[model samples]
Target: MQILTPFKTITVSLFVLFFLTACSNEEATEQTNNTPVAIESGDECHLCGMVIAEFPGPKGELFEGRKSHVRKFCSTRDLMSWYLQPENRPNTKEIYVHDMSRSDWNSPSDEHMINAREAWFVAGSSMKGAMGPTLASFAQKDAAEKFVTKHGGTVLEFKAITMEILNTGSAMNMGSMHH
Candidate 1:
């Protein structure tokens, strides 16, 4: 009975240790998944091959899988274009967009990137991005409205954005060639 008691104690200790380890591992993984990735210079747009740092408007990034595979874009339009394709949308874990309200139009920077899902986008704006029409994003609706007043655009929530809207805006920008 004494030997059996020690064996049972050891078994219970092992189980508790295993459980704790698993929980810690899960917490670590969750943190990793939620953390934002930094964009670096020379990172080419996944769709356009343009160096992302050279752009002056909204930029985008998509992260996928446990490996956190990233696809960076020089423009939000290109990101949306890439996302609308059926093949690229399935594995996407998170999407990020540059918050134009936080960026300097004269010198755009990736430090302004925010969660694309939570952002408010202004389409049909006068601003031109790395590609054509810029999809300016803001963390607040008031900021988007201010952008609309200044640049002439329609404010849209993330979920409300559609491929047709993006296409139309891009076509309009192309027609005007603001850049």
Candidate 2:
């Protein structure tokens, strides 16, 4: 029979502790990796092929459950344009957009990203996105209303936004407006 010395027991315990910590860190990394990824310097919009970083507005990222790649968009408008299509709706695991209330209009940061479906949108704002006209996304309805007061647009829920609104660049025409 073999008995572990004090030094051997301590070393073995430390090795087990280290191994457990490493496994925990790995799981944390995997979970965070599933979340929104930062746009690189040359990342192109999945819908437009335009450089995402060059655009000045809230950006978007879509994750498909069956696919490993994340679809990046230069503007929230373009993201909705693609997402609103029937073919693209299925298998979507997650959708992220910059919270305009928390981010700069000229250079939106990934740190302020929020779920697109839960956000309030301000369409036809004086602010411009990657495209000439874009939807300004906000996490709160009051913020969206304040934006409308300042930028001249309409506050709309995610579902209230329609293809017609995107096409016409006018949320006022939608009839169901918060402002």
Candidate 3:
């Protein structure tokens, strides 16, 4: 075995340190990406600026960027409004919604959230949420159907919710509110 020079030893040590640090950073990033964020009491809706906690219904959140930055919404409708806008549609990693089946509308929390991509939403319900007519998200298809049975709405998946549908519901709700 050859004796190592000081420079070689230092270089080897530095290489090992760099390798370890890179592995650690990758693990940290994975964990952050997989974890869902919570909605705090003072969190405001990105679209309407309403205090999210004040709403007694399902809420929405979008996670974007490498850092997993969150944008909270007072209602599912507002979240859709923001998502449908062309300028706001890039780099979105995940979309979340409060599952009405699991949520305490009186006191909303992160535990109630589910991935909007896989969720079923009840729209055009008689119930008025934070901003106006809002879609209620559910984790299961049966739960969404059950909600519609009691609340009177159409069950729709995330992709099926078109801008026209949203606009029509919003216009109807807004018109009725003033009457």
List TM-scores for all candidates, in order: 0.78, 0.75, 0.80
Report the lDDT tens digits of candidate 2 across residue range 86-137: 8888857688999988998889989999988899999888887887678999
Q: Which candidate model has the greater TM-score, 1 or 3?
A: 3
Number of the top candidate by TM-score? 3
Cα lDDT, all candidates: 0.83, 0.87, 0.85
Comparing 1 and 3 on lDDT, the stronger one: 3
Candidate 1 error regions (>4 Å): 1-32, 177-179
Distance from true location, Cα of 168 in model 2, Å: 0.5
What is the model-wide C-alpha lDDT for candidate 1? 0.83
Residue 130's lDDT within candidate 1 is 88
* TM-score, cand. 3: 0.80
Residue 77 of model 1 has an lDDT of 87
- RMSD per candidate (Å) reads 4.6, 8.3, 4.5
Candidate 1, backbone clash total: 0
Worst 10 residues of 2 by lDDT: 170-179
* lDDT digits (tens) for residues 66-108 of candidate 3: 6677888888899988888777677677898888887776665
Which scores better on lDDT, 1 or 2? Answer: 2
Best by lDDT: 2
What's the number of clashes in each of the models?
Answer: 0, 0, 0
